[model samples]
Target chain A: MNIFFFHLMPYGDLDLSYTDKYDSAWVTLPNTYFDRSKGTAIYDRYIGELSLADELGFDGICVNEHHQTAYGLMPAPNLIAGALTRTTKKAKIAILGRALPLVNNPVAIAEEFAMLDQMSGGRIITGFVRGIGSEYFASGIDPTLSHARYYEAHELILRAWTEPGPFRYHGRHYSFDYVNIWPRPVQLPHPPVWIPSQGSIETIEWCAAKERKYTYLQTFSPIELAQKNFDAYRACAEKAGYKAQASQLGWAIPTYVAETDEIARRELQPHIEAFFNKFLRFPIEMRMPPGYSSIASTKMLIERKYAVRASQQTIDTLGDLGMCIYGSAKTVREKLLHHQKEMGIGNLIAMLQIATQPAEQTEKSMRLFAAEVAPYLRANASTAVAAE
Target chain B: MADNVTTETVDVRGLKLKVQQAGSGETILFLHGAGGSNWTGLLDRLATKYRVLLPEHPGFGRSQIPDWMMSVGDLALFYLDFMTASKLDNVHLAGHSLGGWLTAEIAIRNTTKLRSVSLLAPAGIAVEEAPFGDVFLWNHEQSTRAQFHDQALAEKRLTVAPDLDIALQNKSAVARLAWNPRFSNPQLPFWLHRIDKPTLLLWGREDRVIPYACHVPYKNGIAQAQMETIDLCGHAIHNEKPAEAAAVIEKFLSGVKA
Candidate 1:
């Protein structure tokens, strides 16, 4: 499958023993624990790991946005994408993505993404997200208006990129008298749009209707659940009068590789555990704010009970559940290949750099994955070929 | 008291509303807080003196929320239409928490229709010193704790499990109305002066949700307004101290001419 390296750029030095003092790693977490000097070193190391991934010939490098959270330090993924444009060559700069609802000005997104697309020489993939519910609190945006704002912003950005703007645009959530953008995108029509979701049906249907790529964020869920969601997405696309190709489907999961299974487990298990039990330890209220999700979706979520299990996940449980992949290069390769064949996912975005994982360890995992795992998968599979 | 309470569905404009009506005399409309609509003990105590009309806001309980009804102001207008359709004039108005905010909006907009306004722990005034706690961010347990001074009473009230669908529906409706500008209207202080009728502002001394400091702006802005603090009470003053809340309302309403 097409391999992409995803970086959360986490503050690896967080004292796990003291995580109990904070309600979550998100909005309410005290900033006193964050050391600026340590943060500077972490950024350089994380970005250096991404640069290594580029040198190792990964198909893409992925970054995303989160607010007021140690879960991911990228409040602005665009800036990171811009930095990647200057440092990395050939690998697509995938900002997966900018949270559309949290942003006050949609045109600024249009302008920035266009500038990045031109700077990267048409090697940019734009991903749009309705930020997680905690972001509504951090950004002071109404969670009730999230869907409306997201759709409006998406429409505004697309039109600004394609249509000759400076045209008046009026929407329920936004209104612009003079809608014009300079330095229009290098990609014709627009850069390819991808959407990542936790399998919200509304989002799946929207993505299907728009004929955009849909990436399932299998965050701490069982493989069967992801498969069911993928099936639903394919069915949704079919109902929209088009069959979804493998390239239109993607899977993002935590992955780590090493020389042997024992070594991989020994080295990565603690970091993986901390990532789930600590970094992702958000209270239910913070994760799903009032009106952030629909009644049907909320009811479905309650019935499934995935979120409860996710909160209590241990490293071993996560691995057994297939929420994460950690093993020898051979074992990791086999597992990924099985997932690709079974789920029909063409793109595999591997999150090698986890919470508290050393920079040297991340680089070693990337090199092993690139040398031992990716080459075999690339040679044997034709359907997993990159869309570009 | 239990036998006296009866429930009915009333049509307001195109929306259907579930209303609980009790006793018979001068009409008194009781608006409930953000916590879904229910028959509370205060309703029964008030029912003994005057007819208490408790209608679930358009989106709460068994009510049907029309798409156009999106804000607290829209709810105020809906209630106005309900009064007009019911052929009631110079009716007494009372509300709690979010309901209190709605009552103020109605009073400001339709000054002639109401005889007096009673706001119990109302949440429409912005106070810098004692900012309102974010109820949406709190879990059911945290919210219950913050809403009551008596933890035992809160525990007793919150023991029963909530129906998931109804809980989600109520929370969603509350978010639609009060999520932005948070719980208060920035322009509400400017318009409170328009409400010329006698107003009663009841606050809980230990209300951790909407602070007691919110009383200042309401008292200062409205003419002929009286402010009272209920000691050892919380945001749900009516629920926490039903008898006292009822007695205060009864005394206030008795002096006003309807």
Candidate 2:
């Protein structure tokens, strides 16, 4: 199975105070309060690990973009991806996105991605996003036309990447007399397109139609829902007359591995809970801003399931409920394998942010995951490993 | 922070309003932008000379969500009520972003109450040439990139806010009220001519979030307004370049006889 490790490289400050300790925790602490110096140091350390993953023989290293909020410090994952392209020889530098509509020119994306692909000799994976609803409010994009603009911008960018000569792209959101991208991508027909989704139906169906690889960024979900989403995608792929490959599905969840479940639980719980209580406290009303996505995705969590309810228990246990993994290596491996076997997930993106952890410990967790869990599974899924 | 600058809870049409009052000079009441709290850095500067009153708009900050408040105009009128109840006459109004828009709305209706109106990167003007960078779509990087000259500095200044609860709440409320037309009120330009108070149209030249071209419409529309452009600044002029922004405000305020 091809795997990638991603980190938000949160600002390293011990300031998780005004949160509900249990539910709506993620909405309280803003990402803007992260210590830049510490954030950079952590970024350098983890980015080095991402590079080491290449030496350890992982398929790819993932970095993504988020803004304002402290959940993730990466506002421009592309810049980091660009830097990684220069350092790592073997691993693919997957910029899990450049929020397309937020960008003024898709050609710049075409140019940048092509440059990275050329510089890395075809090791770039570009992910395009409509950017989630919070982003729309942060950047002030009209939510009403988000989908339209995303589709148009994506079409323009794809055309710029594929078509040989300067052509014109006249669309609703973007228009240019001549669309010429210099240094066409090293990979013919552009770098491999990876689409990251929060299980939006349109995104799933779109990826299915195009035969593109998709990752269900299992942010706040549990194994059951993750499996359901994969099932949905498989069904969508089948309906589109194509068999969905395991490589086409990627899963990411916040993970912390330690010597014992108790230790892992003790250390990781507070940080994850702090992240939740401080940053995740938003009522559903703001989170699902109108025209942000198709009404389906937002309504599912808001009016339908009562998932966005404000509560301490709900916030604290959210990660444990579905999306977070905290345990001994054996326990974590078992849980990860459960999801893999159930959903046929080939790509697993692990997040390692446990509050106030020394960089050495975080690196220790990464090293353990790399040395023990990864190699064993890579060789054969049938082999029984000690959970001891 | 002053002693009398107390947080008062007022029952405005059944909603509890959080108003931060400080200092003792002229009655200079401040209105905050979308998602802004009274404690934001900009208000700290204004609190020095004037009896600065920073009220978190309804459905924002710690203020109770008003079910009746429907639009930015509703917020403007509510603020007017707040001033009247406090007996704050000869008001020197200063606002940023949506607050600036609300200030313009208030000046048009209750011109007699305002001593002078200073708008910092106001948002009511419409420009068709170069579109404003969408403030909502920006992640921290894109947001700072759109607003600041230096990425590192902007990142440094943007201490991951302690609590985004207010931001989230404000975003939802703003989205609820303005998402239909995307915060650009089409009818607002028609009302600008009615504002007779001495208006200072302060603009940040590098403001991509609300494109600098927006100043053109205001210049053409408002008869009594004068313009001053601040260089190397963006939409959050007061927050991004406060010294320069405050300098512009001081000049504008000094020009008026309060």
Best TM-score among the predictions, by candidate number = 1
Error of 2 at A129 (Å): 1.6
Tens-digit lDDT string for candidate 1 (B166-226)? 8877887888888878888898999998989889999999999999988999999999899
Candidate 2's residue-wise lDDT over B1-258, tens digit each? Answer: 435568877765556677888777887778777646546555566667667888878777644446556567787888888877767789999887778878888877788888888877777655788675654544345665666655566777577753444555566566545653555678878888888878898888888777788878777778878899987777777667777777777767778864
Q: Candidate 1: list runs displaced more than 4 Å.
A: A210-220, A302-311, A383-388
Displacement of the residue A253 alpha carbon in candidate 2, Å: 1.6
DockQ of each: 0.76, 0.06
Clashing pairs for model 1 are A166-A179, A166-A180
Query: What tens-digit string does per-residue lDDT give for candidate 1 at A199-303?
Result: 767777877774454554444457887888778878987788777777777788889998899999999988999898889877677888877887777677666
Q: Give each model's whole-structure lDDT.
A: 0.85, 0.70
lDDT of 2 by residue, A200-234 (tens): 66777887774454544444566777778878888
